[model samples]
Target: MKALALVAALLLGTAAAGRPPEIALTFDDLPSHGPLPPGETRLSVIDGLVAALKAAHVQHVWGFVNGRGLAREAGTAGVLEKWRAASFPLGNHGWNHSDLDKVGAPSFLDEIDFNTPILTGQMAGQDWHWFRFPYLHEGSDPAQRRAVRDGLATRGYRIAGVTMSFGDFMWNDAYARCAASGNDAAIRQLEQTYLTAATEAARASRHAAQGAMGRDIPYILLMHVGAFDARMLPRLLAQYRREGFRFVTLEQAARDPFYAADVDPRLGAAPTLEARLKDAGGKPLEIPSYSEMLGAICR
Candidate 1:
């Protein structure tokens, strides 16, 4: 019986050792995101997120910042300070979370430049050259895209590519609404939907990566620092762990060849999983939408 149990254990270990998926978690809209629920301050949300990350032993999870949040919301700057105090790195999101596709390339470049001083002050001479595009929209036209890319390169900024996300931002507003209404049942439903979206998204992303790249590339999971996100983060991290994902630093994940363009902004724009799959003639995975689910629940 002992020999049989040992063999089973060995087999399970071998299966688990077979190239577990790697992911780097990144949060956008630092300092502030989504509508706050009753009794929960921005500082409280940051505290929750920081505690969860530290408890999970996830290090160097980058938080992309929009500098305007500091001036727009009093005491929001402390959120960034809290993040830094946790020893996590900060990156540029934009000055006002402006979309490059809407604003011209020149204006978008100025926004990036505008964000530099805050990043410099927060990073304190540390490397904070990574930039995550607002709304994940690079540009609407080829010329615009090229100009922004060139400007980012000149600024010594590397683009942060997002390969896995389930539109987590959508849930934040709904969660806030549900919480405000004191609807425990509705909030519970939101929790389930949020995790379900995340789980399905992870699966879809992995399938897409395999179909497009012929293997799993190190993934960058995009998230927001919303109140509900802070609430669900510990469970979310546990879910990823159960799915056999090994957390890695953004820099380490970017070292993969698939992220070469992202690691060096001088290269062409980093190809998204959707783009790669489209180019490979593979069918795109259907991302689950919670819009209707969220719409009816809180309202």
Candidate 2:
């Protein structure tokens, strides 16, 4: 089966066959994300993830926390402590994962401000000054986007940008459902769907970079700290390795030219580099959305 999988990957011609690509892994919804299976504890989820990171030698992965999520999830502070204990850097994902579009600029900025103290308390002496916009929505308009950008600057925060994501969170939720139902066939299907999606997203982003900048810039992949991720991270990382991805810290990935885009408060927020590229007239990339992917399985 392993040999068959490899053959399938090669035939698809999407495997990383040459120079290794560089990518940084960043997880949002930290402390906890979604309900765990019947018996899984938050500690086990966090510890398992940290262990995977250690085994992968990923020294600088980033995890963003929603202050409210930390408060809502029982014993999440302990889970966050584990991240700090493992030396991972934490950033603010807002007090709640509020969308800037619906919350309005003023409310959204408040959310950003609201998360600081909790995050600061959790991450002493470590640089916890980065902010990832919840839902990757900066604002609905240029003015609103600039408003948040200015607010972040005033608070001494750099926006953590995501360039590649396979919607792992979507796969995770589906996996949890299948696991609960004891559907092994669905579980197997989910794994294959996930790996295939990851490969395709990587390839599309690489091309998007090429079309936009004439080269492949270091990518920052968005994932979540959830039960399925803990179980699958090793395999996911292995697939990335097979495709020639060298894991780098968020700091290192930021050094890539693509991340150097000046945060122009005058411009509206375009979260992913691909979006920015498309806005600048690059070819449209047909990346799948989580809702779109989930519909295929759920239906």
Q: What is the TM-score of each candidate against the true structure?
A: 0.93, 0.88
Cα misplacement distance, residue 250 of candidate 2 (Å): 0.9
lDDT of 1 by residue, 1-299 (tens): 34323433443353386788888999999989999999999999999999999999999999999988888999898999999999999999999999877889999999988988888999998999999999988877989998988888888999999999989898899988899899999988888778777777777787788889988888899999999999999998987776678899999889989888877777878668878888999987676588888877778
Candidate 1 regions with alpha-carbon error over 4 angstroms: 1-17
lDDT of 1: 0.87
How many clashes does each candidate structure show, in the order listed?
0, 1
**lDDT digits (tens) for residues 1-299 of candidate 2:** 46436534652353355556789999999878866865788889899899999998888788998888767766778888899899888998988799888887899889888887877787786678888888777766877777788877777777788888878888767766777778888778777777777877887788787677766778888999888889888888887876767888888877765665423332335346566578668875575555665555533
Q: Go through the candidates in order and give each one's C-alpha lDDT.
A: 0.87, 0.77
Give the Å error, residue 38, model 2: 2.0
- Candidate 2 clash pair list: 16-243
